[model samples]
Target: MVKLIHTLADHGDDVNCCAFSSSLLATCSLDKTIRLYSLSDFSELPHSPLKFHTYAVHWCCFSPSGHLLASCSTDGTTVLWNMQNGQTLAVMEQPSGSPVRVCRFSPDSTCLVSGAADGTVVLWNTQSYKLHRCGSVKDGSLVACAFSPSGDLFVTGSSCGDLTVWDDKMRCLHSEKAHDLGITCCDFSSQPVSDGAQDLQFFRLASCGQDCQIKIWIVSFSHILGFELKYKSTLSGHCAPVLACAFSHDGQMLVSGSVDKSIIVYDANTENILHTLTQHTRYVTTCAFAPNTLLLATGSMDKTVNIWQFDTEALCQARGTEDQLEQFTEDWSEEDVSVWLCEQGLKDLVGIFKMNNIDGKELLNLTKESLADDLKIESLGLRSKVLRKIEELRTKVKSLSSGIPDEFICPITRELMKEPVIASDGYSYEKEAMENWIGKKKRTSPMTNLILPSVVLTPNRTLKMAIDRWLETHQK
Candidate 1:
């Protein structure tokens, strides 16, 4: 149901991780920079570059409180940043890994977890800024890890397709082959169940991998009071590897982003294809749900991030407008002015216009209401022209105020106004005095002086006065 609004090109290379706050979106790219952009205007904001990393940044996430951000890079370090000022809060480094693959904050924002290609997952206490523990998984790289919503449990998935669930005591509670290929990403749902049904309800886990499969699992309590795994479903729609998967906060829907350059939305209960979003031009490496479930954010190798909003009501309203336009246009006819007027009236009521085969003569004879609608449409086309003229005038005013030379100024005073005053006799003279001397009271010296050399000013002045008196009588 979500519609794509706009695509923002914020990076020069692959955008690997994207997360959203209430009004802003943060993206980390292989270009080794993190950029924050405004979700409202799609304009880039001042961002802090993570230059400490010598290579690509693989993962970035915002804390639950939206005040801090955590990022992991190929430089084998995980860093915490203050979101408001973009200052580094802490940095945890590992010596063994070539690159850090994933980093995440605990639900309570007390701890940070990071996975590395060296097959080790390290946990750090945010308050102490020290390593809590390091757990190693053999055979393949540790690619994905996440803490449970209650902060009582955590899970990690690796390149060997193994998933391990651990408790707060660092005791491994569940370990198994969750997939046939390397697990790329995993997320826990936010929904909680009653205490008596805790084990049955906690069965919700969504995982995606290089094998082009998304498996949903339910943890069921056994008769012996131990937890057992039950495969609820496998979503297999992506033609290429699935890179990331996340469940909505309510656990009603699931979103998966893939290297196939598409994101898929599925019903959590039936695993039905709800939508296939294919706006990205390259591989969609990451996707995240906005704080509001109505919006989804996607980052891609195309170096763009897109925000989609789900608005069924808005879409329905737009469709209704189109239908109204169609119905009115079909009923319009030239022979019936009343019918034409009715259709035009209906269009006006709906704030739309439908005109076909309109002629200049008919346009000229249109009623005031219809003419106003046409004029409104015409004004829309002239918006750019009006804006350009306003900009030109603003520039001219600025230049004049800054003492720039202009041709439209009076030569003597250098002011932007009309002609100069001239003195004629020993007494202080003005245009009124010169006109009275020539007997043409309204004529200035420039006019009287021109006639004085060729003809008598008295006869010329009398002829002008007779013409002016006759014109004044006719105007009355």
Candidate 2:
């Protein structure tokens, strides 16, 4: 039941990408303008329709530290902006007459990497904003790029279905055919080493393609002049090509968006699809979770952005050891199981419900098609187990409606504060806002005209849990 919290409008054309900084939400579009909106008040910043690009902007991203915003456009250039002043800090232009497909910042924020339609990858030093290194791939058209967590290696995917990994020393580590049709997106996920874990399995890469499948790969370093990449698994659910993918901040969940107009959430460790969201009307171009929040933002061809908050709790629990029918045995009578199954209101044409003491009221409401689909596989084996698994999956999804009062919003940002804290003045404010007010503004208490007793702020755990509950129940 994720609800749409807001729909930002201003672009006259297609919205290409949306990115978040510490204080701003930056969006770029085919309108040729990159707009900045305040995360605090949810209002457009003053003088913000950055119009330096002559053509449609293709991608936008904020550096890891949130100090700089970068974008690439069909105009063959990637522009870096100093977000504090809405001014262009530097422009890295390619004269190859092709759209600069994508741009991403290194984990340290010291370097910017971009891939272009001409198959060129350029790295720029953030201090001087000058070209640090230029490299090319043999496949020709580049579509996606990402940096490993250690910032030691970079990966790129091509329209010709090839994936290449490059070392920081300006050398290619591994290049191979990654997808059948071509790669549309790629992301990285890492796992903390535990006892008995394979060292090479610590780093995993997820990539999607026009083949309508997502692949996970195990990445490891080699002692020689290269790295080893091995296929981990293939995920299949989307009917159309998956155009975008992202790993949650903690790397516990992996989400993918497809031209099929749906998004799929997966349990990264088990490769199980936790949910398939089908609320968007057109191609879901991009999807991203808030920095450290459960809130997910998605853009579409329908000229809108949707904020979806998911409850991964139920999915997590289903994976836990607890189960209602865990004690059931094959010898359990059908009459005994019918009592619980009847409550779910599913029946086969064989009148299994009717024979099992199901009332006419429950029997008449049965959805024949859905019942038949699941029951059709019962004859093969494990009829009771199949029924239980189906019921468990259905129980994980829920829908609810609720709203947050204005008192829950932060005073600085009219938008709902995902994290709230209290200052020494005994007033609640968004954590970042309180920090910015005291450190950047060098001001006294925001609530009183006196000097604060302490600059330290305490987490409002009560409010944070309340917000989390609200988001989970009212997810759209």
Candidate 3:
């Protein structure tokens, strides 16, 4: 459930974008100004209504640490502002002198990227506040951009319906047509999924466009294979063109706003709708999730920004009931198995299952031979039916373990390491495995494929502690 917490009707014209940091909220508009408010009280900051942009402001984003803010404008420049004082830190002019449409900061806050109407993308050094590198799309205006959580890659979407992926060095890695009409917005989820082989790491990317559809893609990266983007699924919930989409900080939920003047919140994993919001009176142009809260901020063409709070307690209760039934099949007792058998129309087998005390774990281990010999089932069809159900249970259990963190897996062994060590290349690896590789006179870094400067390895106590904590929590 969602509740309207507060509404800020301050902008005189259409609100172009809205962003939230841990403690503050920001909104920019066609009124040619940006506003800041404190999340604690929903009160406007005293030095707010920042007024440097000479034309309409198109987009605004806060740095990862919430210390600085970046806003782009039709004036052909993107300005970096000091969040504490609302003072301009730097003004970067687009090389093509075209109106800047979108801007984003890298996850580490070391780089700032801005996209312009002339199809040009500029990477800026956040420390020096100077241009670092530049690239361009082939056909249309660059409208959307997002950085992957690893900070090694980023993606840009253009009005020509193309999506381009680039590495941190500003080199194009891959390009493809993602939408038929035009791409408006895109985002990368922070959660990483382990590819079934455990050798690859995959992140989900959601892209929405003027084609009135949202597409999810699986973006994987490996040391040897580099990056690969594959189509995953499509979401067709909105009746009109979707304008904006954002993943929650946990990456479990996705919220999107559309020209239909509605917002749809979805369970990111299942692609199921959680709720739909229709409080906005005009086209909803932008939406964002707070860094560390259940609050959401949405901007609309009606010149207002609305803050919505989700009832997470209620949501958790509803999902908990469903999870108990669908997930953790290995924890079911004998009675639970009997009920499931009856539900599957195997009521006649319940007597046999109870006589043998077949619990969930034993049921999942039942093979054709076990069903025929141990259970003493005479019918071949009955054995096949039991085996098929067991196979289905095994498949579901494997999928539940797909969310293991990539950092926990050693790059060389492709498995969780008991002793993590940092090598000269600054990448962690299993200690014994890395020592064997180094002993073989192979003086190269497995991750970067570069020559190692020294043969020393240090214990990665911090990474080891993190892995330990994760295991303790998940194992429970």
Candidate 4:
């Protein structure tokens, strides 16, 4: 089951869209600013709000490289901001005649494209922010746009229910009706190549709309190497019109959110609904799936962003270690940190990261397995006060990493429980917090407030050991 892990509360107005990078998150709002947050713990990052848009910022998009953020606005400008320093790197200005509604990075991150109110899609170069090319949607008002996984085809949906395609050279390729009503959002699924059918090469395109339906299209290359989008199937469960849709990074699952205030997860392979979540109080406007893990984020008109997790041991193990943190820290330069470590006789700690490239925060995030996959550190110990200081830092990183394991977390406090104890019930909880419930407040179990048999809390030695071991192994 997908569970709510965190709720971020910052945006004052409606959050229109959210973009996920490997380690960071960006959310643009009607508050006229784009804010960045740490995906590790949903903590708001410092020096954010790449603010300058005159009106509500409609969408925030991360480049494929994850180092740049582009925020488009109703004011007809797309500002590309540097992810590290929150500085405006470049701005793509469009005619004041139209608001740039949607912008996306090409698969290569070398180019960015956006659809404006004028029914024109403009492509800009990343380096100079110059016009690389532009394509005009010849039919009706362009409501949504996206690039295929291969970057060979560009697709757009219009207010008149028309869908248009363009080749890499910006030539009009095809135009057709994709929905009975206007299309709101669209995404191309990551290819499922693991089945190893060499003859079967196609990606699924999931689009949601005002018609309260989701259409999965089989996008494939034609016999002449041309591209084509074939209608596959329709998914309907939302009682109200669908607003947004997103695919898991691996393209195995698809999730849709709607005005009905419900979110549905679908098995992309079988086209069946996996789970339906009714946690949002208002219309859901934005939804995103983290690229590296089984994490989903949904933002709604309720002024909140809900972070959900689809936890599985296999999914967690499949996530890759991020390689770049050279630009992550605030004060210390990447090379300077490495030099400081070596000069301070802490090269062994540097070796723990395996990769030579990392910053202070990234180094703190290294897991025990990443530090010593072969049990090389098993035989090693602090053996000194310096190493003991590093152990103290383990507590500090508890706030920076993704979060503590669910098992170690206290149910009531929703924080890591250092001193766990079992109550009359089978469930375990933090010693002091549980005591406050039974003794101070004279209440019963929080999970099930049944009459306490006897307010006697016993140490859960087994769980305590596991928590201690986790802390020890993560002591940097």
Best by lDDT: 3
Candidate 2 residue lDDT tens string, 192-240: 2111112222367899999998988766553332355656557756889
Candidate 4 C-alpha lDDT tens digits along 124-194: 88888898887787666676778888787778887777778877777777777777888888888877322
Pairs that collide in candidate 2 are 1-475, 2-475, 2-476, 3-475, 3-476, 40-413
lDDT of each: 0.65, 0.71, 0.86, 0.73
Candidate 1: list runs displaced more than 4 Å: 48-50, 95-97, 193-195, 198-203, 220-227, 312-476
RMSD of 4: 22.8
Residue clash pairs of candidate 4: none
**Model 4 worst lDDT run, 10 consecutive residues:** 318-327
lDDT of 1 by residue, 28-59 (tens): 99998888776778677666454556789998
Q: What would the per-residue lDDT of candidate 3 be over residues 304-335, giving only the tens digit for each residue? A: 99999989898787556435644667788898
